[model samples]
Target: MKLQPNLLLRLGFRQNARLRHFTGVGTSLVYREYGDPQKVIVRREDVIPKLKDDQVLVRMLAAPVNPADINTVQGVYAVKPQLPSVPGNEGVGEVVEVGKNIESELQPGNYVIPRVNAFGTWRTHVVTTSSEIIKIPSDVDIAMAATIAVNPGTAYRMLKDFSPLNSGDTVIQNGANSAVGQAVIQIAATLGVKTINVVRDRPAISVLKEHLTKLGATVVVTENELRKSEEVKSLPQPKLALNCVSGQSGTEILRKLSPHGVMVTYGGMSRQPVTVPVGAFIFNNVTLRGFWMTHWNKEHFSHPKRHQMLNELFQLAKTGGLQPPNHSLVPFSDYHIALKNAMPREGMLCKKQILIF
Candidate 1:
């Protein structure tokens, strides 16, 4: 007297409210077409099919709503998934079941995260190939694990790859209030590197400055202050400049770079092109570059550096050296609330939103 898969899922959804453990059914925020996430993404529940020989069943614990996730849903990001896709780029989950033929060391109860981008992490459960996910240290905070692979990884790599920064070296950057910027401050502090953090002015500028300063920013200044402040002018010119906000902000940081310094542009929060002065390149020999974590992962798929970076970040989390960005945890059932808070609005400082399953 075996029941059908759909019927089994229906029963599981009705009977198991806590979701403390996997029950062969899960919900997902799926978008059938490219549009605004709020207008297109909908929650749906379905049966969890049995695993293939190479697949593993993961009970998702938590996932963050990153800006990239929103851009991917709107069909504007560099990486677009096929329509009718789930939208999530990073998350942490627990292994609930493993296919019998799995040859790797993965087993039930191990915590894992997708090794590749666009793995559809905004779901309650996932069945993915063994190679698609990688195990992470189980002791780290779930929120930190859920958010680590993107922002912190970006900060770490930009510091290491673009230049040979040693202790006491200075790095300057715009968008200091962003998650990646905060990570840069903390990671740089650990290495004894100094950071000049530039952020937009707000009504509560003092509070923002305090927050970033606590995170290890040597100095926090607004865009206008970056231009007029004698303090900024007096410090040693940075060898590395990190630009996430382009337009005038980008040029401001570039002007502060030392001769033969490097500037890495990873994002354009202002949606404006980066403007560089001719003298900065010709006279100063400054270099301009870009970094995309997804592309880096693709190029270094099996590189040992990837594992080393992850382990170092995990250690930082355990020791409180790296902290999860300011965030709000919204229950997975209240996904609409999370979306509303996460969506960008004029003059609004949105906290990172993590969905707890």
Candidate 2:
């Protein structure tokens, strides 16, 4: 067929690669320096980038206000974005235009999420390579899609990579109310693995326990309970422990691990170091390791296993093996509320604040 000028305008969702078109530009939450998000990030309207031969243009639909995204802006995260960069690190976007010679399935209107870190996903649009965007089912929830890369992937990897778990094996983790913790409960339930989830003691504790129970947490306990409750002693020795709240929450969960089991530390939500009894190291023979999804992605970007794992996670969401995180949407223009909501207030912080552009 003869090629038409500006082909991107004619294609519904499968626009031909040769048609280059522009949707003008977009607004981005940009920061020129590392500082508080409220002080560093500002509204900036800029021209959308022209597509390069190997690139595809994506229109961002939604991006979540994750703590890591905030920490990166504050210069606290281990991975910092170069100055004068956008702040979002993970989100869901749609292909709106593509380079004339781009060779991939990322045609106009296709749904995709960034396949790599530091792609600056917190904006209205982005110009990224076809190979850097992971294709997702077009019909998936945009909010769920935006938030998937970090939490679910971390939970999935921690569940599978750190230890060898069988159908009946037990796993223990702290921060059971966190996004990753919720994911761990659901994913473990799907795999028939039992989970003993530990959360902080708080008012209306039963409400939180009921919520996690619905997601299939085999047992939900408070820090005090995990440490001293007789109920905790009745369960089998957990073969694996996942720790994100690295203080007392981690300490108690680590003590419950079966001898020779592994404890994987992924975060320090409490801003405290992980400490265990000397006896744990000397007598229990427990192994301690850490996982960073960013490092893992850097190592596996080109590997088929990366794609396979992402695909499996998406499939799990599609089939209800997972439930989307509790999220409150904020318009791109009104991002102040999003930032405020993302912060811990009155000691509660599990709800996600998402930016919808």
Which run of 10 residues does model 2 get worst, by summed lDDT? 1-10
The residue-by-residue lDDT of candidate 2 on 1-357, one tens digit each, is 122345433432243345545646577888999988888789888776556777788878888988888888989999886789988888998877778778656677788888878888778778878778888888787887888889999999999898899998899999889999999999999999999999887887998999999999999998877777665677788999999989877888898999998999999988999998888999999999999999999999878978888888888889989887888988888898899789765547457998887
Off by over 4 Å in 2: 1-20
- Every model's TM-score: 0.93, 0.92
Off by over 4 Å in 1: 1-23
TM-score of 2: 0.92
lDDT of 1 at 275: 94
Least accurate stretch of 10 residues (summed lDDT) in model 1? 13-22
Q: 222-257 in candidate 1: lDDT tens per residue? A: 998997888777778899999999888999999999
